[model samples]
Target chain A: SQKTINPNYSNRGMTLEEDINESNLYYLTNGIAVIHKKPTPVQIVSVDYPKRSAAVIKEAYFKQQSTTDYNGVYRGKYIDFEAKETKNKTSFPLQNFHEHQIEHMKAVVKQGGICFVLLRFTNSDEVFLLEAKHLFPYWDESIKGGRKSIPKKIIETIGYHVPIHLHPRIDYLKVIDHLYFNQ
Target chain B: SQKTINPNYSNRGMTLEEDINESNLYYLTNGIAVIHKKPTPVQIVSVDYPKRSAAVIKEAYFKQQSTTDYNGVYRGKYIDFEAKETKNKTSFPLQNFHEHQIEHMKAVVKQGGICFVLLRFTNSDEVFLLEAKHLFPYWDESIKGGRKSIPKKIIETIGYHVPIHLHPRIDYLKVIDHLYFNQ
Candidate 1:
């Protein structure tokens, strides 16, 4: 018997979320890393318990988060980061990060944890791992009448380019190993 | 004019969640540690934007998490744990923990992360920090037709009693420092 798959499903593009999830799953399965994206926070206003099964939330609102999207343990060290995708061709906008996230990253860095941002250039299909130390200067400079966005050339120079791999999709730990772990 | 305050609000007891949050905040502000409760995972089914200040989630369901409730960086090490309070005085039931959470703790342990559970006995007004290594054997025993609950006597012997404090409320990290970090 021949099974026919939906063409529309096959034609769907993989979002950054899906790609990272797949990569995290790969890392988890291989015992390489234990990073996971935090679930989207929601404020539940009301709930309805319809008979058996489970209770259904009748009303809710998406809540603002005070930290980054992803965090976990990597090689006995705390690894924390946020991932953002930009369609802009020239530079990556700083507006993608919230003030609380910046403060959170600063705290993580102060605690001697690895803190970074995974920036994806959608136009070029390139991903770069930018450290929080590098990101903070741009964030601080923006308030000091500096450029609100980081130029691509600067990112290309300072940021480590994450190689895309078949199993992990984004072999980010490879970059982390090379840059931080002296591998 | 004197402002009237509700006595009921003042008399209300603080939950375990509030206690932990307050403790984490104290830890953060004092530069002692960086720990946070992961936001409750919610599955958003529908959303509506009625030209408002914020988008409202019309329909959603609370999702079960595979990981523990709280995790963060402490002394350059990954700290992961779940906090649970029980009314039962004799023992802590294994049913409080899901299989996936057990698996998550196991993974964190394997990754050299400090993993534990903060068990609070509501009736006794006592809290204990039980390490994952201590927890795993009991969980494994349950599968082999053993007791489904960890005896309070056993927990009292194996787990370190977390001292309650005024500002932080539940200072479990102090126990962690003593037990794991040798401080």
Candidate 2:
């Protein structure tokens, strides 16, 4: 029997979370990068052992981490980044980022690692790779009553748009190339 | 009243975990490294909302992670490692490691990041920094019916013993310098 292809798959049916996960898998399968979403840290207060199969955690609490998600290595350079998506079309809000994450990116940059943000605008179906250096101004200005959002024109000027691909789906390395390698 | 001082304050009172945590904190505070123990990951199945401000997780399960305990950047180098403490003085058992963690370390190394294990023997209060490259052969041998343990003598020869100090208790970076940087 001929299988009916789901129409949603043809479009960007996947959420930003799913797309980034697919992108990481793509990187892994191609041996291009070794990035992973750091699991949400939790403090376990109690656990239950059931027949030695696997210990089950019975009581836990979410922990506040000092860093952002997705950090690893690429081409002998440390790669540390975070991904966030918003449905708004006008601008990306600075409030989406936390202070500690900004400090972490600064630390990574000071250590000479590649640091950036993967911003996805679902409304326009655009994905941008924004360098941490460009992000610093908006972060600094927001503290002094400047607009809490980064205008689309600013992102379009400074960020590289990641093209969608059939095989890898979210082929972010191509954008990384244009932004970092000038390819 | 002035606090009574014990002469043994620097001799011994802290646990192995405390020493390592203190060392990690020192590294982080000094901006030397960003490594941290990943708090246990858990899946919350139910939660009790006691008040508007408190949401307590009532039921949860431990989630198996596909990576190691500590990972971050150190001096422009991506650092991924694990720490284990054992009371046995004769040897450090191979069973202390998980298969997934070994695989994760291999991936980290392939991506040009430093991967290693920090083994502390609580009985002798000695901590050794063992590079992943040296550990791999023993892991392979264990699978081929060899002794499932890394003997103290072998560890002494191949691993650099981390010296504990008052400020930075675990000071594994000093050992890393001796092993990796040849300093």
Candidate 3:
């Protein structure tokens, strides 16, 4: 018996992370943007240094990030954003974002940076770039006895639908260009 | 015999890292800027999850960062830089910078972001913010049969001396404001 390989094996269930990372790499290589996903924060409790080699971390724990996931410079402006994916078809749950992330976004917006969330409806394979300003109202509403989720209908209306492209899988900057730069 | 505690125990002989971290925190709290030191990259080989609050990383190695250590948004612009300390009094060695960092800086500068190196001469207790534009020539020269280090006198003349203050210990943005923002 021989192993049968599926035609779409490589990309059968490509993750949102993989898509965005590929897009960022594409943007970086083309000199279009200088975006990067900040490395995962870890708290190292102990380390052992070998004689001639690098230090080996013996004990560590994952630390919660104080800021958003991805951030960088684009066209002389600061770009900050968080990327999230949901399996639900109807709405994106508010639980995906932390209070600290919201605060970080608020700070980023306060400092004149473009802040947004790249929300992916994994089931639908649709992506949207929702601005931080739009997110705040919903986030605040949730805290004050409002709906705990943003309906897909409202997101479809308010958020720019990001199209997936060949070179850049998720061409989010195209949406940003249209929304911010008008070009 | 009782151990005598020095009055300047906390402040005396503070490393450049401590000064910058304090300054960044101050800037963040004051809403002046949103700068952060990127977390140290770690390549986790094993993780142990014992049905606890957090996953513990058991075995990991420090990963070399592909980009600079510090980056953030400041006054609607992308700010990116690396902080380095040198004990040598006469010159700043070119070997301190990796090729990847130089490439990253070049990419950032090309994208119209503010890029620089925060260099500290520990012996002299002096710090300088040397712009990426000024650094490239010396970097290129070193590759083309030129001096492997930038002389102290040259750095003193070209780079902006970052003044240490009470609130923000290493007030580097002040130099940026003077150089780039015309404030």
Candidate 4:
């Protein structure tokens, strides 16, 4: 019964991924955007094929995603980003992101795609949209033995605040429109 | 083992997927494009987490993809497509495409994204890049008692011939550039 329950974002207990997925569904249904979370990569080592039933994956392991979690077409531009939430009250840990994902975001930015990250502070329920360009310097500094986490105070300065809404729960596209389209 | 062999495109034995993968890698390496094949969707049912080892997926099944197999950005545009190879020499069967993939293509096209399908006739070793707009009419007619397949001759007229090359084996972006960018 609990598994069949419809996702309701009225309660603030929903994870960041759930909130974004619901928002993406709303965007898709309204013809506003077509963003989707990429499927988890799995390495299927062996499978069993029954004569009359569906094939079953008997052995498999999860693989590292080579790119960001979410990407799609929005307003004729390529949209790509990773969504992360932190429980820490003071800073967002850079360890939440992998080095390969950073490189992938750089590639997306080089191709002129709209690349960004959605960082949420779970304690305060605050979400910010930080562009990939603004994040590169932090990543570069971390490799040189700089701080491995970004202070919440600095994040608020450079990132756009994404206010939550009822229809599209996260409403990150509004932030994109304001930052890029001047709408 | 044969699995360890390096992918060499000088010969013609490689599948359409392999060709496109190598092409995407070349494009990514050269900063030409950022296309990637989406991983196969799997519905995980159970997992076994050993204390000292990786979490192993104990039960899973393949899930039908709701979108195309491949998508990414190119020249600041959202590019999306599905690739299928048929052994038939005279016609390409429409059954190879799922209903939801067509719907997904329609959404991408509406968003002004470049959407198309790569049809490869394995018998004749020919590949054609047919835009989603061009394929829609045939799909519509099929539901109203029209032919369930597109003739190879018709494909030649309606689609662009993707010439094979050494570095980027498929060279599908050339067709995109010529048709969309007039380059």
Candidate 4: residue A145 Cα off by (Å): 0.9
Residue-level lDDT of model 1, residues A1-183, one tens digit each, is 111223332312577778889899999998988999998888888998888868788778787788999999989889999999999999999989899999999999999899999998887677888999999999999978888999988998888877776667777898789878899
Worst 10 residues of 4 chain B by lDDT: B1-10
Clashing residue pairs in candidate 3 are none
Model 2: docking quality category:
medium
Candidate 2 stretches greater than 4 Å from native: A1-11, A43-59, A178-183, B1-15, B47-55
The worst-scoring run of ten residues by lDDT in candidate 1 chain A lies at A1-10
- Candidate 4: true contacts recovered, fraction: 0.82
Order candidates by lDDT, high to low.
4, 3, 1, 2
Instruction: Give the per-residue lDDT digits (tens) of candidate 2, residues A52-117.
Output: 677767666776666878788886668888888888998999888999999989888887778999
Better lDDT candidate (1, 3): 3
Model 4 chain A weakest lDDT span, ten residues long: A1-10
Candidate 1, DockQ to 2 decimals?
0.65
Residue B19, candidate 4: alpha-carbon lDDT? 94
Share of true Cα-Cα contacts across chains kept by each model: 0.78, 0.65, 0.93, 0.82
What C-alpha lDDT do the candidate models reach, one value each? 0.85, 0.79, 0.88, 0.89
Question: Taking the tens digit of each residue's C-alpha lDDT, what string does model 3 give over A147-172?
Answer: 99999989988898886766588889
- Candidate ranking (DockQ, best to worst): 4, 3, 1, 2
